[model samples]
Target: MALAGVRVVELAGLAPVPFCGMILADFGAKVIRVDRTKVTMAMDTQARGKRSLALNLKTPEGVSVLRKLCVQSDVVLEPYRKGVMEKLGLGPEELLKENPRLIYARLTGYGQSGSYAAAAGHDINYLAMSGLLSMLGRRGEKPYAPLNLVADFAGGGLTCALGVVMALLERSQSGRGQVIDTSMVEGAAYVGSFMWKSRSIGMWNNPRGENMLDSGAPFYDTYQTSDRKYMAVGAIEPQFYSQLLHGLGLDDADLPSQMSFSDWPKLRQVFTDCFATKTQAEWRAVFDGTDACVTPVLSLEEVSSHPHNQQRESFLQDSQGEESPRPAPVLSRTPAQPCQGRDPFIGEHTRAVLEEYGYQPQDIDRMLSTGVLECNAAKARL
Candidate 1:
């Protein structure tokens, strides 16, 4: 309920911007996603708790409707490359002139003014440009794209959401709005700040996969169990390492020094052979309540039943019976809630939203009839 009464106009986009808008919605903002007319909808986790208003932005009337929404919204999260919104006459300058208190947040791959500002890009492209891509993956393998989590969600979405909250807090004092130019490349670099800063002091002086945290150390990586399942291990400190050794029934005298990089291959083989003797469940039982910092590597299907995740109610099922992660960083007094039933279909609230904005029913009907707006009439596919 922190963002209760806050209205956000989210121009429907791909992963990052929608994720940022979802964060705002999770914290009680009234988020209206301006979706393209006839967009295909599937099981949308990011669309949770958002109202959809499908509009043909190619039309002048549709653009005017969007402008009206922006003029009345507290925040506008746009996900286009530079000048895309300006071409539609809904740029920050135009809208902020009409509404000085609007927080105009732009989520893009490159930025508004950089040389690559208008280049086509996805999460992988952004990560490569951000300089974090070179530091990921195994020792000698080509850098593995980590499923887009680094740039798309953590860096771009989470970073923009944090910026939006900070801007809202500042707006309470300044009584004015400002533009937030959030570039995914820059945001990814900022999120990987520790990796960048630590290298200066030799924390990451080694090659990409040779660092302690990046599976360089035998104790800080995953091991395959007898059942072909995996267990994640992070026994870095001496005490934890001792526990890990004990859990594996290995004597300290038989192993090399914990931090001896030269002996990691041998240590890792010893660990691999030890772990292969037991199933993941057996290993989990060995280290469950200990300080070994060992845990099973849960698959998506297994996450809902995991004890810690279940204890915290970290995931909840939607109307589709698909379990997805819940709103995070729980607040005591005003905790977030799951979507009551289902996310809106494209343009599910098109007419209702127009009426709420004081548009006449006749006008809305005319817009719908003229292809300026759209409402959900077809049955949703699952």
Candidate 2:
């Protein structure tokens, strides 16, 4: 229980919200997720390790219950449009007044304030606004979504969680609470800082997949093998590139010139021809444990069973029989464990959670009857 005894509250939604809860729970925090009565399997997996309470925020009782939790929590995570929390009576300002030591983390697609703050957006929109879309895909193809990984997890979830931790540390000294305004767009822009600097200095081009790290450098790209499997090579240094060329037994007279960018097309042609003669496994054998900086591009199904990953126990099966991503960066002591329980169905722990929060059982029942709180859909009827 890394976050043992620390109380956190989560206003649940999509990726960032549930991912944050998972992180906190992994560290041993008592995370209470406020979920709607309806539950989905995706939500269940992400919502693991947290207690759930269903409160129809449309009702005054639901709002009341949330306000009480705010008073008692050390941190609160909300991923909504800027004013949605305020509309539900759980905005940062109001919550800070209730718990001055609380770390209020707000995650949204735009931000707390901006011309686009009120506009609807998603991961793809953020990527486009941050100039990341200009560098994706081949030169002639349209930009594909880099999945939701960039904006949702790295930009949104990780930024919010890190900000909350920083705020918590500051609060220890000042005994005060603060609002962390985390926007997916701004976070994505921060992540592209290196690209911005490179472009400013003329070392980078915005053309899609035509720059050094994209597909420009023959030594730093993916190549297909005879079996149609792919391998990635990152032999960037001169010595490493030489080693790669030497290890592959290419004749020096036939090798492409290394320093001439204009010759990259010709060199790339040579590499393509050389690599196509062998399978991925053959290349792996040639470069294994070498300075050529080469490796096979393994699929997700193959990765977990890879020798290195299996030895490191990078993936673990939980008690629920789900093979979930494991806790990372092994600590010397107080190691984090795989989450054991299924994601609680909405309000599955409503009565127990309210009791722990100091509400009497009868009072809890009254709230349920009056629609201030509800557990499952069946309770909504009576």
Candidate 3:
């Protein structure tokens, strides 16, 4: 694997941090999550393929142990509010000094140095602040948040992972690592570059749901079928649009011009009525191998059974029957794999990790006894 032998010390946090670590781990990096001894397990699905080391960083012994691990690790991922790590004396300045080649990454909603850096915010707030949220939804409806995928996972986690890989590539040439400051707000805006550029090209001046790709055209929207299930249509090109009309049993001579904005409402109604005449499955069969660019809008439960998804193994089920998406962007020679192990309980590998970091068995025992470290006895028994 591309990231084999790379060691990552991940400070446990929420979605973005664990997601970044997961991407690295999927590619064969050794990821050790530094969890808090007193905290409960986070609701982060990205925790798979990682080992946990629970320690109380408030204690000097815990801090000392983390510093030692950072010294031997290639990357240190921190996702705290700005200045929190600095207050804890574990900021980039301190950790990078111990390992000059360590990539110290910080992920946050705002950024390290911004007016709203210290303010509390979530994925929606970040997307709104980035102006991307204002462009979503129908014309008369309020802009809808596209779940948490945009800012949290895509902008924050995926962007940070890319930064880590780029930094590592640079490190091979410079033999030195650097800091990566990632803000979800900025990253969200960056990923929406096409939307911003469209405005300048006169292709995006209309309000939400009134633009070419924003469901303004009848050919690029979803229609309800007779069974109430939906079918998504993206027959944008002239040839594809002809295919869509042919499948709908309509001819160009019987309809208004395709590019006539004033005719969209009528065209949409015609398309909607035609789609409502058939069940989604019926429409799917009609467009299955055609260039109509029509597909069913599948529910979460239906996705795993889809023929294409099953053939590609896009989602993998674990031994416990819990399903999760597999690593993507398939590499021909060194494809990434799903995490082989289940998510670790808190402090499951504390003793082993400490010993690997050169701490004596006696020292680890003392730390555990003194409340500086913790180990999950149940996991240890296993």
* RMSD values, in order shown: 1.6, 2.8, 1.3
Indicate the residue-level lDDT of 64 in model 1: 91
What lDDT score is found at residue 261 in candidate 3?
82
Q: List, residue by residue over 1-382, the lDDT tens digit for candidate 3.
A: 8899899999998998999999999998899999998766656578878899998999887888888888799998988999998887888998888788999989999999979999889999999999999998986899999999899988999999999999999999999999999999999999999999889987788889888788888889999999999999999999999999999999999998888888998999999999999999999999999999999999989988989999999988876688878898899888887676678888989998989888899998999999999989575577
The most accurate candidate by lDDT is: 1
Q: Is candidate 2 or candidate 3 better by lDDT?
A: 3
Question: Residue 347, candidate 1: how far off, in angstroms?
Answer: 0.9
lDDT of 3 at 155: 91
Q: Which stretches of candidate 2 lie over 4 Å from their true place?
A: 38-44, 376-382
In candidate 2, position 24 carries an lDDT of: 77
lDDT of 1 by residue, 105-190 (tens): 99999989879999999999999999999999889888877999988998899999998999999999999999999998999999
Compared with the true structure, all predictions reach lDDT values of 0.91, 0.80, 0.90
Compared with the true structure, what per-residue lDDT tens digits does model 2 show for residues 53-140? 8878877777888899878889888888878888877888888877888888888888999799888888999988887877777657
Alpha-carbon shift of residue 51 in model 1 (angstroms): 0.8
